[model samples]
Target: MSRVDSNNERLMILSDVTKVYPMGDTQVEALRGVNLQIKSREFIAVLGPSGSGKSTIMHILGCLDTPTSGTYHLDGAAIQGLNPNELAEIRNRKIGFVFQSFHLLPRATACENVELPMVFAGINATDRKACAERVLDQVGLKERTRHLPNELSGGERQRVAIARALVNRPSILLADEPTGNLDSRSGAEILALFEELHTEGRTVILVTHDEMIASRAQRVIRILDGRIGQGSSDNHGRKE
Candidate 1:
């Protein structure tokens, strides 16, 4: 596998970021002064146990939420204060998300499921179908394009999810515990596919709690107590 070159352009920067949530009369800080940088074409894992605020970080990175304090710059554009509609636009244009649950619509075929994002983006039927088939072929699911989720195996379903994620050709592919529901063999296949995508120059950020899973990335960022710890290291134990 090709590693992320240190000279790659910077894709994202988080400066002293923080996130807060309100509960009744109490306020909870989900992230506390976290700073991070990610480069284009980098495959990295955000590793954290439950309640460590990794999900908050993911939300911020994915443009699903904004920071409570500090600044986030994606591709040189400030992201901390964008409105919901603006954020949604950025998400549709720049980020692709894959979740553990393989959120495929039960009534849709693989091709139709992959075409949903383009449908939202107002892509016409012909282009949507073409792009969907192209990505499904890229993900090794061309033959299964007509199959529904229930007709596929766990790995195949996840592949369809991946195809859906990639159909937009987003700059960053963010996967949250992507293999959490798969058997070991299927999970390995998905990881291999991720590596393949990384080699093809896609920026992949995998948010996972499993050490073994995190270890597959080129670098790992560990979060604890809503803060980025000193344990952010490469696979060889070098600080990133």
Candidate 2:
């Protein structure tokens, strides 16, 4: 049987994208004329200052928000004007999210937290359990599957979050400040895991403000005042 990924076209495409938000009589442009493309297995870092629109770009790429203008294409599907349901479908099937806070339920065990998305997607009980367990194991949390969020260390909790993000086999992994809350050692471990995932041919977009961490990515995109800064590149190593 042919692998499903053999059919993958370009993973993502964005052209002249701009996102504007209206507040009272003023309009704030969160993203301005952003043009970008990401291939199937690239590791990219979106780097910028606090108000520089890195998060905005991540949201648009993850299908959580639509651009006010211009076009977006994900895995060959045009997403310019897709409605909420369509956007949700694309997010569920193609994008996985990892945030700095982990976002695990305080009362739920690690396995249960990892299984929530599959449950929402109507996966069978047995399949959900198996899938969650496998992913937790992948994130090195097999022994802590039964522990609740408060019982795990910071690193372990983030690992659980990563497991939850990976449970659905999504085509793209979006990590927003993934190591922000961890110490240097733990952050290093998480970065190593990202590199491992990249080596395994996953499309990983890491959003961060730290230059050291951003440098670890194969390509780095820096945004400033809602516009692309100098670091944006067409090829991984090419500036133009």
Candidate 3:
């Protein structure tokens, strides 16, 4: 896997990106010539209602899918032309994803769950455990490392998921409706954690439909009808 250059300021750029799916004889346009750019260490929120292409955009940005047309550049690398193996390599090395579903293995302990990514990366057992514990502690779940998913609260489980995502030290953190399954307080706590990560200089992209949730981000980019709507300025009031 190629390492993303730390000196590169533009972390992601999508120009005239579009995605289409064929259903029977009809074609569905999920994204319509979307254009977006995200710089390093920016906390951005992509907000849209259900079936509004937000999820599709997230998939493409996360390298889970490719654009049908146009270009996507990530950390100075052209992404749309990469093969499946190359895409997977980039996703594993440079992107961390936290979804609405905790997606934790029911049988695995918090430490084990967080170790899965490193496992796939071919890290040895000792290092994987150590890294997992360190990240779990970073997420404030140090004492619960031995606990299973069912034993942890919703927020704690989400924290474990976040810890898993961070275990690899990816260049970008992509979260899709991360707080959707938690209570209001839990959700707030998760958002706080995201903010803390952002302050630590991680590029965090949050995808959600909730205004209140989206408001927590430094910048909010609204999406509607498969296209980007007006976007708010960054926290410093500077437009990117």
Candidate 4:
């Protein structure tokens, strides 16, 4: 288990985190000394324009990439210097990621896609299958469990992806532009689902450029030019 403190108030922390990308003789800083803290069940939005480092933050939060410098503690464990395999293990065990593109298996059904995470965790066939079915139903896809990516509508496919993300019961649901490719109605539906998850005490961190979507969260952290800007939201929120 991660080294949770007695108070157990924080789920993740980043202290002066920085990420630099190699660009020939020069280096581009993607994240610049970012400091953030997330509690166990807070819903947050990391909002910024393209190239503003929100995506980099998302990658780091999801354990898809580590920062070039500084510290990150997720679920009370220090994650700054973990090896690739260790990072992969942490990702599989603690983070559930939903991306802009639904990266479902082209040949698999919805339940099969949802079961992929458990397969990596060495879950037995019977339990994994049953869990997949239950989560798919939770995401409002009970009737579409057998549908292939090509057979489902965009919204349904996104819901399947959400189901896949939830199958492992991760500590955090990290989404990157989850409704970016959907129509207004579909996007609203997906956002509603995110809100539902938040209401149920799940930790949700959404990275998006859409202000409307960001507004739905309880707190919003604005990133600008690879640095955190002023007036970031507190626990109390910014609006009525």
Candidate 5:
């Protein structure tokens, strides 16, 4: 959450990162010596299939999990050894997450759902409402602010979810399978919205199994069997 990168240059750095899980009598490696760097305003995609460890990378990038070994620096501050509370603060204040499921409160109105993050962060009701409304407008859901999740279409619900993610104005937008639940038309619309956000200078990191979806990003890093793949095979098989 602290802005250690005063030069405003790099946003994230990972060096020889690894993650291993204890599974009964055996150990499972989810990440293997991953090294990566992300600058502010970059749009990146972690492209992989199930069990390829892309999600683990996302979790580490979002500060939801720590690397089992190696270092991770965000905003130029080393984060590998931070406590859970510290990590939670970082996740809440610096990372905006979009999941395959819309993850909105079923009973809350769209505006209220978007306001939830700020509410937890102790923002006043007035400010939360205003910020939520503004982001909803940005995501093309201004008129549907009062609609509940069940009252809106699939695309509209996802828009509300995105509005919530943007309300924090976090340092990075990390999306995991963001378009997985939508139809092709709606998914394309969502991708366009993300493009618009990237244009506005937000750091966007998309994690998805679909190669076509990853192709939309400016850069793609493929993962396979818990390790970064060696590939000149860029998005959609286009050479970079």
Candidate 6:
């Protein structure tokens, strides 16, 4: 079991975080004083309307984009001023991301697509291949490892993406609209996979506009106008 303490074992922390974008002479506030804590093995949903800054929060958490102000700590390391290379290293080592569009290289097979991140991190051929194959099998994509993205169904492609995300064995899996492009059946399959991962002690943070999808998470954070709203829950699907 993972111990919870400020001194150790916290998977993610965001304190008074804000991201401001320069729009001509003015600034657009993407995230306003957002404060959140995500512990190891927690399944969280950051839910909000389209412009509510959930995207900004996701970007910050994934290390894909930096906040304009405030602090973010991942596994006890302060990450506010880390440079691109450093951030990339952290992203590769600690964060796994699944986006709605299923960002797989068109020319690559499922196994090859899943191996991309590990490749960038300098994992050798044998180990990388093994890791990719293992994760693909775990995600129920073993039979599709040789298939190209176009050859697979939408759900299959998404599963491939999930396998790719897990190939690096990241402690935190950050998914953005993971079910957005899938049908209800596919979406539910994805949610079930998330549940399985959560049960297996992975920290899963999912961002989505669908309350139904958000319902799967144990915690739901509703954001409005760039700040957290007045709602909170471990039962997001319950009647409002």
Candidate 3 or 2, higher lDDT: 3
lDDT of 6 by residue, 1-240 (tens): 123355436678999999999999999999999998877777899999898999899999999988888999988898999999999999998888999989899999999999999998899999999999999999998888999999998899999999988888888899999989999899899989988987887999999998888877888989888898897676524522
lDDT of all predictions, in order shown? 0.91, 0.88, 0.91, 0.90, 0.88, 0.89
- In what order do the candidates fall by lDDT, top score first? 1, 3, 4, 6, 5, 2
Taking all chains together, each candidate's TM-score versus the true structure is 0.93, 0.91, 0.92, 0.93, 0.91, 0.93
| Model 4 TM-score, 2 decimals | 0.93
Q: Is candidate 1 or candidate 5 better by TM-score?
A: 1
> Over 4 Å off in model 3, which ranges?
1-8, 231-233, 238-240
CA RMSD of each candidate after superposition: 2.9, 4.3, 4.2, 3.5, 4.2, 3.1
Q: Residues 115-146, candidate 1, lDDT per residue (tens digit)?
A: 99998899999999999999999998989999
- How far off is residue 3 in model 1, in Å? 14
The CA lDDT at 96 in model 5 is: 91
Model 3 / residue 53 / CA error / Å:
0.6
Number of residue pairs clashing in candidate 6, backbone atoms closer than 3 angstroms, sequence gap of 3 or more or interchain: 0
TM-score, cand. 3: 0.92
lDDT of 5 by residue, 1-240 (tens): 124346548889989999999999999999989988787887889999899999999999999999999999999899988999999888879989888889999999999999998987899999999999999999889899998899998889888988888888886999999999999999999999988888888999999999888878877889998878977133323423
Q: Between candidates 2 and 3, which one is better according to TM-score?
A: 3
> For each candidate, how many residue pairs have backbone atoms clashing (under 3 Å)?
0, 0, 0, 0, 0, 0
Candidates 3 and 5 compared by TM-score, better number: 3
Q: Which scores greater on lDDT, model 1 or model 6?
A: 1
Give model 1's TM-score versus the native structure.
0.93
lDDT of 2 by residue, 147-166 (tens): 99999998999999888878
Q: Residue 69 error for model 6, in Å?
A: 0.7
